[model samples]
Each structure stands twice: as C-alpha cells, then as structure tokens.
Target: MTSVKEQEATRRLMVFLQEWDSAHKVARSHILDNFIKSNDSKTEPELELEFSQGASLFLARLAAWLRMTYTYSTCLRKLLRSIGIFLSAASGHRYLIEFLEIGDVLILLEILGLNYHKEEDKRESVKLLQLIADAGRKYKELICESYGVQSLAKFLATSNSAEAQEDTQILLDSLGHSNPKYQNQVYKGLIAVLPCASPRAQQLALQTLRVMQDVVGEAPTAVVEPVLGVLRSTHLQVQHEAIQLLKVLMAHQVRPALLEGLVAFLTPSCRKELTFCSETAADTATLGLKEPKLVYTQQAAAAKIVGVLAKESAEVAEELIQMKVVHGLMVAVGNLDHVASQRYASISLEYFVHMFPFLEECVKNALGDTLFQHFMDSPETWYTKMDPLQAEELASIVIDIP
Candidate 1:
C-alpha cells in the first residue's frame, strides 16, 4: 500500500516536523519561513491538494510539538504561526472538516487555555479557533461539545486585551447561532464576565447578552442579579444597556423580583438615602466613609421598566400600586430638575390610572391640587414633551378625579 510517492511525501513531512521540533530557534524559524514562503504562491485548492496526502500526520506532529513547547517559548509562537499558515492554506470547509476529524481542532482549543504571556498570542489563538468555527455548523457544534464556549467565557472573563475578548465573543456568538443547546452555557459565560473590572469586557458581555437574549430566555436570578447590579455602573452606556436587557427579560416574563427591584429605584426616599449617604461619605472621607449615589438616568430607567411592566397587565399595575409606587411617581413627575425621569414617571402614572381607575384618589392625594395645577397649567413647558393627547389624558385623570 506504500507507494514510492507516498513514502517520499511522509519522509519530507517528517523532516519538516523534525526541523520544527529542533531546540535551536534559528532552525524553527527556518522551517516557518520556508513554509510560509512556499505557500505564498499557492491557491487554496493547490494547497489543499498538496497537503491532503499527509495532512493528518502533519497535524498530529504539530499538535505533539505544541504540547511539548512551553507557552512563552519562541518555539511555541513559531508553531502557532505555522499552524495558522496551514489553516490559511487549507481555507475551505472540506479541509476544515479534515482537520477536525484528526482532532486538530481540539488541539487548537487546548492551546487557547495555556497562559500565554503575550496578548498577541492569545488573540492569535482565539482567531484560529474562530476560523475553525466559521468553517461550518458542524465545526461549531464540535467546538461547543468540547467545552469551547466555557473556555471562551473563561478567557473573556480573564483576558485584559480587548481584541482577544472581541475575537472570543465572535466565536461564542457563532456557536450560539449554530446550536441552541449551548445557550445556557453561553449565557452563564457572558454573565460571569459581567462583573469583570474591565469596562470593555463588561460592555462586550452586555452587548453579546443583548444579542443572545432571545435564545437565553429567562436567566436565573444569579444571572439577572449581576445585570441589575450593573445598573449602578458609573458608565452611562453600561447602565442603558443593562436597562435594555432588563426590559427584554421583563417583557418575556414578569418576574416579581425584577418588579421589586425596579420599584425600589422609584422610591424618592431611597434616592434621598443614596444622596444623603453620598454627602455624608464626602464629609467623612477623612474617616474612610464610601460615597453611594444613584444617577437620574438609573431612576429614569427604572421608571421606564415600570411603565413596560404595567403595560403588560392590570395585575402588574395593581402590584406596583400596592407597593405604594404612586407616591414615588408623584415625587418624580413633580421634580423638574430631571426631565427624563419625570417623563417616565408620568408614563407610569398614566398606566396606573388607565389600569386601575380607583388609584386616582391615591394619586390625587399624593400630588395635591396646587402641584397638580402646575402639572396641568404648563403642559407646553413640560420637559417631558408629552403630546396633546397624552397631556390631555393625564389632565383628564386629575381633572375628572373630583
């Protein structure tokens, strides 16, 4: 079965593999340089055909070399570069499948787990993994089955490089689309990175979660709890993103815990407590007190979530009413300093009145006539920019209350 042509090809491949495994850095470089140069002029088909003969053996040797090389060794980098070159040469689904069949794909994933000191190496590892996953759905499924999603998540959570995280996220997203089975794992991975000190990681995690929300469905309280904590993030964009995710999650299923969390933000006393704590901490900073504060945007977001929840059903509205949310809404709407919060608060109030007409008395008592007059008299000047019908509806609620 061993023809002379096959014998010569295996011998040449072994020579190249031996050169790659040499202890001298120059020998490894010579092999990589020659390999890249030789492949430069070859088309994918040509490269595929040339390598198809001894591809499995070549990859097996490469994997063994990779396992033996120290993560930070120049030899490891050269080996990775050589693999990348080979992958570039074999750029087709067919070759990708061939590589997968021989366990090279798994080898690439294992390389990713190594604690490489260089960010470039990390990025390159993730890039190669991404290339394999992009080859086809079957490749993606294989990656997921091998715990690729979990590995990427761990990498994402710990990686300091934005480029590396982005690459990993792309792979995870691809796996997510290729198979629904990995949704929960993907979700957990994204959530695990949410609390990372790196803002970019947190943002990428949020963005990925937003895209994966439909597939993720109702996340566990542990997952959702961190997202809620992200609401307090100093970054405005992060806060907005968290709010958007919470809205989507709430829309899918009304969680009482989420409702309770949103309602807490609507409380004026709670906001004041935050402010008071902040001021007191500033005064006592010399004594090591920490400042705690909630931005108006957060309050606005909470009110918006409330409006969305109330619009879902009368029972939800009644739930908020029972929580005494009307008092908070009244305070928010009458606070002219924050127009956005006022607007959302007004929307929530409208939902309350429309859902449970009896709550009108509670709202009326909370606002009193003078402030209610201010609410009605200068509708044009209201920063919320309420339309005439909306303004009228709000006015009708207060006016017809008797």
Candidate 2:
C-alpha cells in the first residue's frame, strides 16, 4: 500500500509536470524557496520532506519536457537547468541526498550526457556533473557503479561535438576523482571502448588514468599492457596523452614483467622510425589519410611495465635486478644514444638510486661517471631531507666502476 504522503507527493509531481508551461515558473520558484527554507530549518524530517517534494516536482517537469521532440518552453528549460544547480549545491544536504532515488540521479545524468540538444543545455549538463562531483565520496559510487560512468564514457567516445566531448571528459574526470571502487570500474569501461575510440576519447582516457592514480594510489601491474597500447597509438596527441599517463604511473614503482616490457621498448633500435602505418585515399577534390595503426616496439611498451615494477619494495627491486633490469637501465644510460631511446631512463635511474646501499656492486658497474654526478646533484629532491653528503657518497659508491 502506498503511504498517504507518497500519494500526495505523486499528485503534486504530476500537477507540476502537466502544467509546466503555466505552473513551472511559479513551481520552480516555490521549490527553490522551499529548498532554501528547508536547508535552514532545525527539523531534519521537515528538511527531508521539503527537499523531496521540490526535487520530485522538478524531476517531473524535466521528464515531461524531455519526452517531447521540443521543449515545452524556454522557462521550463531554464527551470530544469536551475534544478540541476540546486541539486549540486544541495549535495551535502543529507535530506536532499536521501530524497534522491537512483532513478532521480539517472534522470539528471541523462540530461547532462544525452537529453540536452542546445549548447546552453549542454552547459547545464556540465553544471549537474559539477554538482555530483562536488558531492565527493558521498554519492560517488552510487552514481558511478550504476552504469552512469559507462554511459558517459560511451558518449565521450562517440560524440563528435566539441562541447559535448569536453563536458563528458570533465564529468568523467570529476567522478574518477572519487572512490577507488568507482574509479576502477569507470576506468575499465573507458579502456573497453579504446579500439574504436577517437583521439579525444583516447586523450580523455589518459587524463582519467592520471586522476585515478590518486584514487587507486599506484596503478596495478594489470594496467601496464593496456597503457602501453595507448603509448603506441598512431595519433600524436594520443601518444602525448599516453606518455603523460606513463609519467604518473612511473612515480610509483614497477614490476619485473612490466620492467622487462619497458626495457625492451625503450631500447635504441626501437627508435629507428615512427611505427604508425597510414593509407591515403583521394576523393574528387581532396586527399585524406585515416588514423594510422599502432606499431609497438618492445621499448615504448616497456615504459609502463617498468613503472609498475618501480613502485615495489626493496625486496622486489632486488629480485627484479636479479632478473637483469639493473643492467638494462645501466646499458640504456651508458649509451648516450640510448638515453633518449628509453622513455623512462631518468626515472629508472631514480628508482635505482634507492637500491644503492643494498646492491652497491651492481650499481657501480651500471650507473657510470657523468650519470653518477647528475644523480648526486639531484639526490635530495627525490628523497626529502636525507643528508646531501650521504646521498652523494651513496651515489659514488654505487655508480663506481665494477
């Protein structure tokens, strides 16, 4: 049996939805005023009741307007936009959140991602996302895991409109900044769309990956291969974004298998040529080339793998060195020609410095003279307040000739 209050609320929502053209303006103002009053009220139940009534009415109006090929009126559209902002502002209001069903949240998100046709409407969508983003961890997983992220990523990947793409990325990135569970799920969806994704989609994916590092801390080794695949993309911008993502991953450590992959791709021989392949076609008045295919070198692919390994503890580092990465970075750095060839050469050296006291002999043979000084000079920056002399001395001992 439906509660009396729910039945009454439903009636009010229907009235608002039906008389939107005439009553929406008055209804919108009444809802806004009620929201303000409720927020300031001492009674929690009153606040909840007030917010639920206003939100339901606003949602009804939006749903009715969206059902038609054209909006009912400009006032209705503006009211819809205002409601989105109100929800965003009321994000932290416990009452407002409780009043929001999953269906209510989805309605707002759909407006942001799909329903809005005009640029102004799209901007309203961004405002809605911004509101949810502002809600932080509170409603993050609620909005994200419920297929909201997948829909947003799909829109971002397929939509050619620049404003829509930008809004989608902003929305996705904001959500990605939330809880780790949501970030991981959203990232998986983003990556799943990679094959047919446009340059914009790929760029957004990379951006999302960087932000996700905050949520997930260091990215796991599992992300290495897919991230490397991005690095090998034919689009220059995609490559640029991939490298940016790689830099963030490198801040952590790397795993052995991942390190091997980085070492292989960053080798000198792999830099011989650009690896993308493009085929051109001639139209009546123009010639165009489709986006080229990615060609992975054992080297570019290794960068992400190396980064994953670099985030591990000393024991893991020692184990990986035992597997030959210590020699690989040394070889890459020693050969000036190969220094630039390795995408993460400097980063590898930084990771190597941590292993100095434990693996003095291995470092001595690998790091060499000039590289040793650079390490000594830059030692303090990476390790915080450790004594400069200690750092330099360690560098000297480790990078000394075998």
Candidate 3:
C-alpha cells in the first residue's frame, strides 16, 4: 500500500540510514523533516513499518551520531529536538527501550553538562532522558550506570532556567526510588545542590532529598553541614523541606548541628551565639530574621522537628536533652500570641516528658500548672488550637482534620 511518492521518501530514508556515518546534514535534516510531526500524511506506524528495516534505524543512527560528536551544532540541536518527537508516538515505546541500548541515555545526560548548549538544549536532553527514566527502574538504573545522577545535580545547580531545574528534579526523584545501588550517589549529588547559589535549586534539591531519605542507607557525615546550611534560607518552604529531610537523615553527628540550628531560630541572643559553616548562612540567620512573629514561627517549626525526632529515637531524645532543646521548646511555648508556637512547643515537650520524664517541669514551667495539667490530660486539644494557617505551616506530623 506504499504510495509512489511515499516509496521515494522511504528510499531516500533507507539511503540515509545506510550512509549514516557519512550522511550530509541536509539529507539527515530532510529525512527527519515531516516525520517529526505525528500528523503527517504518513504516520509513524506507516513510516516505521514501510521504511525497509523499520523506522527505528533513524533513532539508532541519530544516537550513534550524538555519541560520537563532542561538539554542539544546529544539526545536533535539531536532532535532539527530533528525538522527543519520534520517541513520543504510539509506536515509540520500543524506541525508548532501544535508546538505552544505543547509549543515547548517557549522551543525553552528557548534553546537560556541556557548555555550548543553551539551557533549552540541555532541557531537551533532560526531557529525552526523563522519558527513559520514566519508563521504570531498569531504565532508571541504566541512566545511573551512565552517571546520570551527577550530571542531573550539576544541571539543577547550574541552570538559570526554573523549568529546567524543576524538570531535572523530577528525573532525580524517579532515579532515587528503590534504586539502592545509586541512591547514595543521588543523595550526595542532591546535598551538593543545597549550598548552590539558586534557592530554586536548593528548594528542588530539598524536595527530592525528602523523597530519598527512606532509601538512602547512611546519612553521610558531610551531609550534615549542607543540610543545616539550608535552615537559614529566607524561603520558608526551603527551611521546612530541610526539616523534613532531617527527620529521616538524623545521624548521631547530625544531632548537634540540628540542635544548634533550632536554637539559633529561637531568640536573637541565642542566634548570635551560634554559627553555621557558611558565613552567608550565619548572616542570613542573624540579620535576615527581623519580624518578631516570624521568629516565633521558626521556633514552632524547630519544636515540631525536635518533637518528631525525639518521638522516633531514644538516642535523639538524649541528644536534644544534652543540647538543652527543652529550653528552645520552652521559648516556643512562651510565645502565647502565636498559637502555633505555644501548641507545637508544648506538644514537643510532651515527647520529652513521656520519654525522659525529667523534662515535665520544663513543660509546666512554660505552660504553667493549669495549662500543663490540661496538656497532660488531653494532648489532642493543643492540636485543635491550631488555626488553618498554623496547621498548614507547622503540622506536617499532625493528622489532617476537616
């Protein structure tokens, strides 16, 4: 059923496919021309079935060229752009499988790191890689084997494009899940993004890091500093994401850094006494927090993090006690005007009271005898006092109520 004109086009495609190693750019471009559009008079299935040995030869040839070329060019970009088009058709699933075999996954990842390409070009590469990554874990591990994780982190940290950064974040999230072989590398790569210049990257990194916690085996000692460094971020979401990551990544070495970071958020006097590894982080902690209530909000969040950590591990509870995390919790409970700070701090203190029993007095001291009595009788009431904003901001651990 191949039409005369269609057969001629297919002949040219077969010739181009045969001369792939030496085919001129114009011939390559023309073959890819109308084929890129799925709505062409000749559909992918038709071209694929009729183009002699199948249309995937086009993909194989393209991948071979991408692997061999070290330089970026208009032709390369067009080829890269055409990849997604071909790889998306209904018949494209097999091509996705074939792409990994051709080493295009590695080549696409390398494009993310190369300097000559525009961020858009890099994103196209990311999109293609993301398709392979999205296929499932086997494909994801192939990307990891190709050093996909390191290249992904570098892109997230360096790209000025938010869309590109966010797209890479999704790729990383997929890569990190259940792929234990590469998770630690993925973890390190994301942690490196924590201190990068872009808050967008930092936020994206933290978001992905939160997903990685249950899978990543041991929290590396070097991770503690960069993880703590994010606490000083002006973006509350970034700070909150860091706190979420700490809940699972809390190693013995992490104990003191977390305590110090939490204490720094409590009071101006306390903040001045503490210093993070970065001068900018220290400065952001010291000078960035001017609003009094915002400081109270920070206290509430810290109290919540401490509460969760203490509830989970006896070792963590012991560390918090040694660091006088009780005093910080007490400070939060004393901020009565902010219902969130008082309730979260008091709830946090209950973890210590129940676990260590010695910190009951700290709760009584901060909440007074009457409130402390009610707090012990029914802790759920403290959760109720949280208005919608308070609950949304500070209640990641608390149950959602209508």
Candidate 4:
C-alpha cells in the first residue's frame, strides 16, 4: 500500500537513523548536526508533529538505544538531548503518552535513579517526568502508581543541586494536588528535603507544606524539632518562612515544643534563668532579672501565633496562660521601642481579653499604671494607626470597656 514517494521518504529516514546509530562519533555528530539544522525553523508544535508522526520508529529505536550501555558520553548526551527536546515541545505530552503506553515511564524514572548518569542527564529525565505529570490528571495518577512519588522523594533527599530539589518540589506539589491519596507521600517528601543545606529547598518545602497543610494535617512530631531548629536560622527569609509554617501547624493544634520554641523568641533568657535557678538554688531565688533583648520580627511572629492558637480553643489558652505567655505579650506591648511588636502584642492581648475577660486585671497589673495610662491616653490614635485587622481587634477592646 506504500506509495513510491512514501517509501523513498522512509528510506531516507532510515538512513538518517542508521547514521545516528553509527559506531563512529563523527558520523553520529554529523547526523545530529543535520537534524538540529533541519529543525531550526520548526516551532515546538511543528517539531512535536514531526516526532509524533515518527513516534513508532523513534520510540522503538530509543528503547533499544536505552538498553545499550553507551561507551561515549557524547552519544548518550545527544540521545538524552533528543528525548529532552521531544518532551520540551508544547505537544510533548502526545509523545509522552505514547511512550507511557509502552511502559517507557519506568525507563525514564530509572534514568533518574541511575548513579552513573550525569546530574544534567538526570535533571533532564526529571523534567521529562514533570512534563508528563503536567500533561494531565491521568498521567499524574499513572506516575503515582508507577512509584514516581517514591523515586522523586529519593532523588529530592539525595540530590545536591538546589535547582533540582526545587524542580522536584514543584513536581511533587503538583502531583500531590492531583492525587490526594499520595499526599502523605508528598508530605513526607517535603519533610525529607527540609533539612537540606539549601535554603531554597527548605523554603520551597515549607511553602509546599503551607499550601498542602489541609491535606497534610498536623505535621509529624519528628518534623517539629527540625522545623523549630529552622527558627534560629541566620537567614531571615528562612526564619520567616519557617514561622509561617509553624503558624499553620499551630492553627490546627498547639504543639508544646513549637510553642516553647516561639516562646524562646520572646524570652531567650528563660533557659539561662532556669539554669541559674538550678545552679544557685536558694541564692538566686530573689534575684531581679533584666528583660531579654527581643528581635521585633520574631516577637511579632510569636505574638501572632499565640493569638491564633489562643483563639482556637479554651484549653490552648489555658495552656498558654500556664506558660505565662500572657506576661510576655504584656512586656512586648509595653515596650514602646518597637511599634510592630507593640501592635502584635496588642492583637494577642485583645484575643486573650476576648477569650478570658477575667484576664483584664492581669493585663492591667502587668502594664502597671504608667504604661496603662499611656495606652489609655490616645487609645483611638493607637487603634487607628495599627493594621486594619489589628486595629479592629483594638477597637473591639475599646468598645468592651465598661
């Protein structure tokens, strides 16, 4: 049924393929050069169409080629480059689906697990997998069924490159969104990458966790310690992101360790005070302590988390009160040096007052007459100057005053 023109075209295509598989590097290079040159004017869709039309032939060749161990790095790179190009095209998914149909998904995933492959090659493989997953929901589900989640997690845990880790995080986030059943695996993957030396990975992990928090549920207790450790990170951005994640976790249920960690931000001297109390026993019992230096940003974050947790349940409020968190908020609001911390403290105090009105005497006592009088002097101005949400909280307090 083949026309003469079709048979002639097929013959030339076979010739090009033969040259690509030549043992001589020069012959392979020449063929690849011509292929690239011929495709220079082609758009991705055009390239996709060209590849799709030749899918059966190219896929069969690729499978045999993948089975052979390439002695030449250049040959392997060229082959990977060719596959990468196919996956990168706008209609790459068409070829990807066809490849998946023949169980080539495992072959691609195998390349990701191969220690012998160059990181560049492995990254390209991951990209191809990412493209397939991005193609459609069914592809994502197929990936999950293929244990793609575990492979990606293993790579994310071991990969040295931040860029690779970030790309992996994005892929996992997308896949997690598509397949809720695999979300726990996704959560574990994010947690596995959290302790990586790369700040970007840590940030990405935290960001993905924040988005998936509802499905991920309360973070495993194992992660709580490490996440708390990130709070002390010298990088402000990492600290801020970590605080954001902690806030999310706190909103679900107050973790004692996390609350303790946040309280450390508010009162870094607590450990020293406890140590001194233990060391000196009766001698230091009556010692007057100086206020610890407060990092305003951390103070604000701690106060916001406390406010959120306090409003969540009466039991949490009672726990925070037992930890004397209210006194810390009082000290922060009373500190006139930092307006932001003052606003955060005011917000936390309003939550406490709303939840436990009997705490008014505690607040008034903690502020003392001097600071309390100052707060009352221009309460309206103070409320108006705060962020609208905080301002609303403060206004409510004013309205509730007898």
Model 1 is weakest, by summed lDDT over 10 consecutive residues, at: 276-285
| Clash statistics: count for each candidate | 0, 22, 0, 0
Over the stretch 201-249, how does candidate 2's per-residue lDDT look in tens digits? 7777777777777676756666666665455454556666666676566
Q: Positional deviation of 88 in candidate 1, in angstroms? A: 5.2
TM-score of each: 0.69, 0.50, 0.65, 0.65
Question: How well is each residue in 1-402 modelled by candidate 3, as lDDT tens digits?
Answer: 988987887787767667655657787666566555543344467657656546787777777777776365656666776677656656567777777667677678778878887888788888888777777778888888888888899899889899999899998888888677887888889988887767789889988877776677556677766776665555777767877778767754566766667756544334744334354433233455444544555566666778877887887788777776766665555454667666777788777788766566655654546656777887735544434553333322221111
Backbone clashes in candidate 2 total 22
| Residue-by-residue lDDT tens digits, candidate 1, 1-402 | 998987887777677656655646666667667766776545566664566455545555665666556454675655666666556554444545555566766666666677754766767777778777777777677788888877788788777787888888887887777577666777887887776555566777888888887877766776555675555455666666776676566655546667666666665445434321132212111123223234454467677667776776667777776676666665556555567778888777777766776765655564556544544555324435544444334322332232
Best candidate according to TM-score: 1
Q: Candidate 1 regions off by >4 Å?
A: 1-23, 33-44, 48-58, 75-78, 88-116, 135-138, 216-222, 268-291, 294-300, 307-323, 330-361, 377-402
Query: Stretches of candidate 3 above 4 Å error?
Result: 1-33, 39-47, 50-53, 64-70, 75-77, 88-102, 135-138, 249-257, 264-274, 280-322, 326-402
**Model 1 per-residue lDDT at 301:** 64
User: Which has the higher lDDT value, candidate number 1 or candidate number 4?
Assistant: 1
The numbered model that scores best in lDDT is: 3
Report the candidate with higher TM-score, 1 versus 4. Answer: 1
Ranking 1 against 2 by lDDT, winner: 1
